[model samples]
Target: MSDYDVIVLGGGPGGYIAAERLGHAGRKVLLVEADALGGTCLNVGCIPTKALLNAAKTYEHAKHGSNLGIHTSDISVDWTELQKWKAQTVTTLVKGVGFAEKKAGVTVVKGYGTFDGPGRVTVRFDADGASGSGPAQRAESYTGDHVILATGSVPVMPPIPGAKDNPHVVDSTGMLAVDAIPPRLAVIGGGVIGLEFASLFATLGSEVTVVEMLPEIVPFMDAELAPMLRKALGNVAFKLSCTVTAIDGGSVKYTTADGSAEAVEADVVLMAVGRRPAVQGWGAESSGLEVSGKGVAVDDRMRTNLPNVWAIGDVTGRSLLAHAAYRMGEVAAANILDPEAHRRGEVMRWGTIPWAVYSIPEAAGIGLTEAQARAKGGNVQTVTVPGAMSGRFVAENGVKAPGAAKLVYDGDTLQVLGLHVVGSYASEMVWGASVVLETELTITDLRQVVFPHPTVSELIREAAWAAKA
Candidate 1:
């Protein structure tokens, strides 16, 4: 039995990052994984999907290249080549993550790790591969002083009738791997993932129909941004306040808000409902851990009920975002190494976290919305500007597209409370607002910072200046 100071299970973004941090802090660390190191975000979820989306975007540009005075003929999408490129990109990045782990002196163990006790883990693996052929082919067990659970979440497959049996139905993972674009794709959820895929498929000539259970698509975002996104996805159809009842071979039966059942013909049904934390099959029960339907409960320090056994990332159910998981991992590693470092209690401020939906006209925001601030009983003021004012937007995507920016301020203190943007490269611009919010910068403080002319970032500064005025 090998022993280490820290043993991280599930070497995804959270676990691997924690292990690297712990190892760098002069603690002996071992990071174990059943699959790749970068987890879902790098391997299957975020990176590859974005690559595919970029390809679709390029395809769309090429298809309409003639309108832009770029004469192009016989523009075609090579599916096999696109898949190969996406796979290569994923491979390169995943290898880089593994290389970083090794450079950080983290012992990477490949297998399924089960918690044997509070600080003990037994890693089991099949003896068929390279690690199995030699003397290292057998299952192994290791004990550590501190254990971190970073097992990520998987896409949730809804329990709709006939949803599972149909071959036309595909989850986010399968949808990303699809070699051929469907002629007509029906997306079940109107959240980030669904809308992203809808944008991709619609731009690629797929008759896309997004059926959202909520009243609006991207329901978690500001309702004001929804209209802009809806206008951007003019090609795609939306059935709001709808519930999917059943999905047969090529038809989806759904109930409208009016309680009428209707079936839509679909060559492909993409399920983008959401993802649930992957907490099962890791011997969480043996550790006397309490897991709600969402995920394992953790305090601000990421500590579970059991001492020395903590959870982070999607497993904690706080925020399933990769960056959120990375932050939690850093906190967990710091708290584990030196308990007194962050004992003053840290706030999981969701407002400061930048949220992005990678639709065609991307929507992103940092800090509180106008409605959220007003609900908090603050005298809130807001300012909005059209995207056409930004020369960058006009230069890159042209002035024809519509975009807007909203800035919210505390009326009493004149502090910048929130920044919302819905337009071209809105996701990119939100990072600037994130910095302002993280620093707790007032509207006056933001106004002091000079922004270069003809840039989208200027919109953020302009919005802040307007709010202050």
Candidate 2:
């Protein structure tokens, strides 16, 4: 068996980044993947979906350009062309990541790896039987001093009747690969994935309806941001506090808030409930690791109970985000090299991590929400502003709907407790506040800094000033 100093299983953002970092640190590393190099984010989940969403947005703009005093006619979307473009974009980026792996001197092994013991892995290649290179026909094993598990998650398909058999039923991956837009689309669940698809299809000229079991969409985000997103996607229908009982043919049956059952007919039904970690076939039992509802249990340094074995990314299930997984990879790598180094150092804080929902007029925030701050028994202060005040908003001169910037402050320390933005490019602006929140910058420190006029970022400064410490 080939051996190395480090072995990273699953070449997602977490795995590849850890491999690259270890290789650059002058350690012999092997990066293994079951599928493409870039994993879900690039292959299906984030990157390709964003490209499609952008295309949908462009189509919307072209269709409504006349409203903005820019006259245009005969607006049409060639979905085949759009899909082609999106695939090309994804291919370029995935190839770039492979190139980077070579440049970093990390060996890229393409196969499914399962933990055989504390410091050993058995890799089996996936099946492609045309040229006698089928999965069962080709297999390999490698041992390492350290092993990092970064296998990501898969979509959760609830046990609703006819869900698996119906051709109209689809998951997030299926939704991403649709060749053409359906006339009527029924999206099940109102979490991030559901809303994002609703926004994309609504913009792409599909009659979209989102049925959510919860009382609100994106229940995890601050309540204030939810209303803004709802208002932005006015064309989409929302059925909150509703439960899907079953699906048959192209009809979805659900119970509304009033305890009455109803059915909606649609060309497509997207099951966007959530995703779970891929831990079934990885031989967790043999490795003596514990699995819980969340995922594999690990300490702060991402080390499993077993020695020289670590887990990160969706497999660890701390946070499902790609960036969070990347950070966990770093922690796991550090702990592997020198456990004492991590043990003697400060632990990374999960909160204050920036999160964004890439729907129309994206929603993003960092730090605490106003309600969260108040719930923690702080004398909370807040300030909000409409996006119209920003020069960039004026330049676009789009219909001024409702958008706001909120700043939550601690009355005693005069420090920023939270910052939330719900408007165009809110994700981009949150980075500025993230720095402030991460560093625990006081309001007085913000005051001394000069903000360039007429930029959307200035709104953050204005919101900070309005907090009045």
lDDT of 2 by residue, 226-288 (tens): 878887879899988999999998899999999999988999999999889988887886677
Backbone clashes in model 1, listed as residue pairs: 132-137
Cα-based TM-score, every candidate: 0.95, 0.95
Question: Would you list the C-alpha lDDT of every candidate in the order shown?
Answer: 0.84, 0.84
Tell me the tens digit of each residue's lDDT in model 1 across 229-300: 888888899999999999998798999999999988999999999999988878886678878888998888
Off by over 4 Å in 1: 129-138, 343-348
lDDT of 1: 0.84
Worst 10 residues of 1 by lDDT: 128-137
Off by over 4 Å in 2: 126-135, 343-347, 397-399
